[model samples]
Target: MRSVFVTGTDTGVGKTVVAGGLAGGLASMGYSVGVMKPVATGGILINGEITSSDLLFLQAAIGNTALDEKALSMPYCLKTPAAPAIA
Candidate 1:
């Protein structure tokens, strides 16, 4: 199986866009694509739970909800709009 690790120069630098696009492209080529952000910051509180928009995009691209969005993508969520360590 092939894998990819996508990182950015800094936060909010279109990392999600690039990652999602790559997953979509791979899926279209008949490959099983999985995306994991590992850590996210600046999560919005919805219904008393933290969530990030990037994870949502990744879920949509993969077309599966069995993969835990929080566990698979956002293991750590920071409230402030900054780095995880800083926020």
Candidate 2:
């Protein structure tokens, strides 16, 4: 099994685009792909549940929704603007 990890030194650096493109491309080639966005900060709070926008975008971009969108995300969520480490 092969895996790819997408990251950046800062936010808004096209990490999602790059990662999603790779996953989508691999899926188009008939490869089974799964995405796990381990950590995400500044998630939107809806109905008292913290959610990651990145995870949602990735799910749609890779055309993967095998599991619930919230299931693929980390258990803990932060609402800070900084990265998970900094926040």
Candidate 3:
């Protein structure tokens, strides 16, 4: 199996777009794709659970809920909207 890691020098970059696009494209080509945000800040609480918008977006791009495992997709979600180092 192959894996791709996307990162940016700062926030507000096209990391999500690029990563999602890649995942979507691969899935469209009938390849098994898995997306993991690993760590995310600025998460919102929904039903007393921390939700990561990035993970949701990736899930949508993949066109499936197979990546719905919050514990695995977003292992470290912080409520504060700041960098992990600070949050």
Candidate 4:
């Protein structure tokens, strides 16, 4: 099992895009991928669920495969766009 982590000083950077690209690349090479976020503050309401678009893109890049048990757990959800510490 291999893993990569991407972090930055601010939001709206290329974290999601880069992660998705890496996942896509790995998936193209026939490796299964799992995407996760420990805490995400803001997200869109999709199908009655608050979902992070960043995560959505990452998951899509990895394809619609069944995620493992840990990845199936819910994320820390917040309603505002502010930092998690204050949200």
lDDT of each: 0.76, 0.74, 0.86, 0.70
After superposing candidate 1, which stretches have Cα over 4 Å from the reference? 65-69
TM-score of each model, paired residue for residue: 0.79, 0.78, 0.90, 0.79
Give the alpha carbon lDDT tens digit for every residue of 1-87 in model 4.
887887876777877788888889999899977777667778677657676666677777887533332235236656578864577
lDDT ranking from best to worst? 3, 1, 2, 4
Per-residue lDDT value at 71 in model 2: 56
Q: Tell me the lDDT of candidate 4.
A: 0.70
Which candidate, 2 or 3, has the higher lDDT? 3
**What pairs collide in candidate 1?**
none
- Quote the lDDT for 19 in model 2: 84
43: Cα error in model 1, Å: 0.5
Please list the residue runs of candidate 3 whose C-alpha ends up more than 4 Å from where it truly belongs after superposition.
Answer: 66-68
The residue pairs found clashing in candidate 2 are none
In candidate 3, what are the lDDT values of residues 1-87, reduced to their tens digit?
Answer: 999999998888889899999999999999999888988899988778888888899988988665347787889988889965577
RMSD of 3: 1.6
Which candidate has the highest TM-score of all? 3
How far in Å is the alpha carbon of 66 misplaced in model 2?
A: 6.2
Q: Estimate the TM-score for candidate 2.
A: 0.78
The per-residue C-alpha lDDT of model 1 at residue 32 equals 81
- Model 1 vs. true fold: TM: 0.79
